[model samples]
Target: MDKRDWLILQMVYAEKNITKAAKRLYISQPTLTYRLQQIEKEFDIKLFYRGRRGVDFTEQGELLVKYAENMLKQQQDMEELLWNTGNEVRGTLRLSVSRTFAFYQLPQVLKAFNKRFPKVEFHVNTGVNIDVIQSIYKQDAHIGIVRGDHSWPSNKKTITEENITILSYNKIDLKDLPSMRRISYKTDPTLEMVIDNWWKENFSSPPISNMNVDNVEIAKRMVLNGLGYCIAPSIVLEKNDQLHKIFLCDTTGSPIVWKTRVLYREELLELAMVREFVHFIQDYH
Candidate 1:
């Protein structure tokens, strides 16, 4: 079997559903099924059994999946090694980034990087900061960009820092936080903890959340509409936005700061593409 075959097997194993896997591989459902049949015939074994919900791998199929994973990983390593030995920074750069950074910063950085290394390719995944960290730890990505502080045992560098702020359409006092309606979003856990701790330090009661949003961008919009006030990292806020903002501070009156970091395994730095991309990010802004 070739690399495409191995990739099909891996995608099928990850997605379980043939239709989903076919869509991800950019192949027709019938084509994917035919390929799977060919692979099974070549091995003389049934790799999976389709049920009402999806497909389940047999014991042999599980073994094949492991083999496919190892083969793909080795192939990637070889490719990276070859590219590293050469002077050209041409290879896939797998990256995982927090949603906020992905939305606010990644596009410009990627545009500039692509201009510099036109032959280089990117495989990017955007999620919460914890997910970004996990991707780096698992070696699923060559690099990770995360917000807030995390205790990751890897090479990391701070890219930027911003203050967490209480934002509203109109001016408000710190003591009025408990009385006002607060807009909250599901975001980085470390940021959540910081905000929670800051709120708890000054007041006996929790800040009342008026709306629950999926991301900080939405929460910021809601706050701008005068729906409610929100606690947000300053990076996501636009400078020209008319919202009144107050920087959150610790009990000693120091600003509560949020830092963005780029994380990666030390060994990945050996690859030219990874090294170049990391350097580009470090010099960005």
Candidate 2:
């Protein structure tokens, strides 16, 4: 099988549903089916069995999936070696970044990097910190940018830190927070834990949340409208100068900090592109 065939196998294995795989591969369902049939025919074995819900890999298919993963990894290593031998830093740099960073920080970094290495291409996956870490672990992304601290069996570097604060439209006392109308939004679990811990330490009762929003941006807007207060990372409040900010601190009086970090497998650093990007980001902040 060729590179495309190997890639198809990888994508199919990653996404169990044929329709989903086809969409991700940017091909027609019929085409993907035909290709899968060809692969099975060549190997004289069924790769996967389709059920009512989705598909399950057969024994032979599972073995082939492992082989396909190794082949793809080797292919990438060979390409990296060739590029490095020639002292070139140009290739697809796959990245997984936190949703908040993707929205506020990634665009500027990409613009600067693109200017320096016009030949390099980027494939970015934006999600919560947990998803970012998972993508990196699965080799779907070459690097990850995440917020808050978590255990990772890989090389990690802290990029920056920001304070978590209680935000409101008007000046408010911390003692009154438990009784105030709070705006809550969906966020990463680590941040949620941090907020929960801080709340537990400071109040006997839970902070009343009257409004529930989908994301931090929306919650910030609601707070801007004087709907309620929110606790958010400092990055989210960079442009909101008028907002009253009361920085959260631990019992010892140190500011509660949210850190952003870059994570990658050490072996990926062998690639000149990956190494260059890592250094670029390190110097960026």
Residue-by-residue lDDT tens digits, candidate 1, 112-213: 999999989999999988788888878899999988878888799998989999999999988998999999999877788999999888999988986999
Q: Which runs in model 1 stand beyond 4 Å of their true positions?
A: none
How does each model score on lDDT? Answer: 0.91, 0.91
Could you give candidate 2's per-residue lDDT for residues 21-48 as a string of tens digits?
9999999999999999999999999999
Q: Tell me the deviation in Å of residue 195 in model 1.
A: 0.8
Q: Give the TM-score of candidate 1.
A: 0.95
Tally clashing residue pairs in candidate 1. 0
Tell me which residue pairs clash in candidate 1: none
User: Candidate 2, 281: how far from true, in Å?
Assistant: 1.5
